[model samples]
Target: MIDQLLKMADGPLQDLLSQSGMSGTESTASAIEDTFGSLLKNKAQSGDLSAIKEMFSGSDTSPQSPVIQNLAGDLSSGLMDRLGISSEQAMSLAKTALPLLMNFFNQRINEAPQANEDIMNSVVKALQGGPGSGGADILGSLLGGGKGGGMDLGGLMNMGKGLFK
Candidate 1:
């Protein structure tokens, strides 16, 4: 899944990364992608559904959002390590780049139904190995998993209004 994500990132996301002033364009983009992926996975594994829900919930993806702030920090830390840049530079780049990255992921996730399925599986699996947790149920509802139903991310946003509240 992450490989597919990186392949997808090779185009516009890469350009976006370069535009964001990341020092090592190609490597930094890969690192950023990995950081975001790991963030999602770790959040799921930790049963931090609120954070995950907030991220994908579509209310906001800007740097001001708490989830995005954390994402930026994570991306900044990665940039610092990988590019040998200072914290200020890394954070400035992260702030400039994160909304784009979030929008990219949202678009990619919408276009790729399989990614949505994969996420559902990950969320369910991570939430205590499945089924009993609200993560599975909310995810099922979010993705419309059963009964010949599937929804795009926009649809998820609309239904999500009722989901985590």
Candidate 2:
């Protein structure tokens, strides 16, 4: 299950790594962390009827949507079902895994000699948005979207950029 989740992330992970100057280690770390967050968010939002409908019902009917297909195949079946993960379990797993993943991701970002804000923004948006749809609220909460709190990607990015020559 974890392998499949990792596989699903490979392309995007490579894209971010190549474009953003993140090292292989950093890319793996970011991908793992992001995947963990996505798992939690998807689980939390599993029962949102409207979101589910939107996911299933496309705006256009021009062949099967690859994004939707991957969501169902990789996320819903490969990761979720294989692990038998419930929302609570997913939350618990994320809590345990996030710090480790962040360490790896941050280490790589810090190693880079240059920083690109646009790339950073894209990565942040992708994390916030999850795989296919919905899940933003769940991720926001998991990422510190509470009173006087939110995931401070800006600070991290700035710090990383500063470390570069």
Candidate 3:
């Protein structure tokens, strides 16, 4: 699922990186991936379905909520410091890439009912946070079996690495 999301965002992300003069760098790509992964993990840990829904709804024209705004700000600062870009460029990249990424997920969910249910179920399970609390387990189940079978953590990690590459 992470791989699919990253793949979907690759073109637009590349374009954003290019605009910031950080194009074609694997480290930059990895940072972007990490930022996204962190945000999703935080949301899963929080167990707030409505917050997650609002983040990915793709229907909010209003300003981003504080949680998202803070994430974008932090991401921008990190990118700016790491990649030697101006703050404006970094913030622009974050602002642009985040919405694009969310919209991609929204579109995917809307287009596939099974996938939508599976994702929501995974989110709920992650919130439960007991034996199978990790995002890898949730995403692994989504990728492997929709029946909530055993998680392949290694496989999920490898898939995430491959996506960044």
lDDT of each: 0.57, 0.37, 0.58
Task: Evaluate model 3: give its TM-score.
Answer: 0.60
Q: Which residue segments of model 1 deviate by more than 4 Å?
A: 21-23, 54-60, 108-165
For model 2, how does the per-residue alpha-carbon lDDT over 1-165 read when each residue is reduced to its tens digit? Answer: 222223434554555545645355354445444554465346434532321222223133122334333333333332344455665543433333333333333444434444433333323433434432122222233344423323365654454355322
Give the root-mean-square deviation of each candidate in angstroms: 8.3, 16.9, 6.5
Q: How does residue 17 of candidate 3 score in lDDT?
A: 68
Using TM-score as the measure, the top candidate is 3
How does candidate 1 score on lDDT? Answer: 0.57
Alpha-carbon runs more than 4 Å astray in model 2: 1-82, 86-88, 116-118, 122-165
Model 1 RMSD vs true structure: 8.3
What is the per-residue lDDT of model 1 for residues 45-99, given as tens digits with 9 covering 90 to 100? 7776644555343344766877767777877887788778899988987787677
Error of 3 at 28 (Å): 3.0
User: Compared to the true structure, candidate 1 yields what TM-score?
Assistant: 0.59
Cα distance off (Å), candidate 1, residue 101: 2.1
TM of each candidate vs. truth = 0.59, 0.28, 0.60
Q: Which residue pairs in model 2 clash with each other? A: none
As a whole number from 0 to 100, the lDDT of residue 7 in candidate 1 is 48
